[model samples]
Target: MAGRLYLVPAWLSEDAPVESVLPTTVLERIRTLNDFVVEDAKSARRFLTACGHPGPMRDVAMKELNEHTAARDVPDLLEAVRAGRDVGLLSEAGVPAVADPGSLLVAAAHAEGIAVVPLSGPSSIVLALMASGLEGQRFRFLGYLPADASERTKAILELEKRSARERETQVFIETPYRNDALFASLLESCRPGTRIAIAVDLTGPEESVRMQAVEAWRRKPATIGKRPATFLLLA
Candidate 1:
């Protein structure tokens, strides 16, 4: 039988300790996996160390899987699992394959009939949605919005309309550095009464999740700076 493919989740914030966000059981299973496909090998190594991996760091096997990884090269990363050696798939943060590049590897594992198991851990997206006070029954995660200002504004407007028409909540994320610009576009493009939720620094000491009308937000504008944040809109 082919070895299993484990989808391991990382902590929401780099500043957080592994024990705080991940259960002991998951960390123990992680230590047993020798091969890994990760968004950043260096970061994965650091995470493993923090989780109390017993082996020497140099002995662990890891392969890079990020935006720079080519589609044609994805299949090669799963060879170890196909050969009956369990492999772990880890992301830079949060869950693997959820808005992360590891999804390609997961797809390849499924295509090859490998058993993929997802371990429980902190997810900034799900954490944000659960705390946003928005309609959780029906919602959509739009991933990262367009980089261009005009296109982003257009997307904000379209998602807002969808929220109102379907009574669904819209969730999205931004590069920490571009969070300010995205917040501005949301305030400017969304209707005044449309509800907006901002969840920032999730699973960190300074975590904040607030919900308010766009009009109210205009009165007391917030500067998100470079903190990671998730935005939810319900119209």
Candidate 2:
């Protein structure tokens, strides 16, 4: 039988899931997951060390498969599958491949008749929406706003219009540094009553989910884009 492809989920806390493995039944699962495919091998190793189990650096294999990863490297992931390696792909934070890397590996795995399993836990997008105070029943996740300020503003206005017309929550993320500009654009584009949610450092000690009417946020002085964040706009 082909080896298992375990997609493990790390916690939002600095202490990774490996620490949770000691609490009881989680230990069994930890033993089963001996191999890993992480987006940031260095970070994973650091987290594991922080968990009080400093393992070898190579314990988690990473072939630079990221947003900037070349399409050619997609095949290495397949080669690993044929070797019957049970690799666990993880994102730097939150869920893997949800606006993170791992899709190439997944697609490659599928093409090679290997299994792809998704281990769920904290997803910033879902968490943000749940606390967004928006119409969660119907929502759309727009991965990222354009880098160009002009186009970014256009996307904000268009997303707001979508929420107004369809009553759907439109979600997107921005580079942490660009978050303030994105909020500025949102203030100028979205309707006054349109709802906006900015979830920051989710699941971390500094986690905060702010919900406000677009108009009020303007007066309150926006507080997004300074830290790692996920943005949601609701009609």
lDDT by residue for model 1 (109-189), tens: 889889999999999889999999999999999899999999998898899999999999999999999999999999999
lDDT of 2 by residue, 54-153 (tens): 3455564555567778877776765555677777676777667667767777777777778877665667788888987888899999898999989987
Pairs in clash, predicted candidate 1:
none
Q: Work out the TM-score per prediction.
A: 0.97, 0.87
lDDT of each: 0.93, 0.73
lDDT of 2: 0.73
- Scored by TM-score, the top model is 1
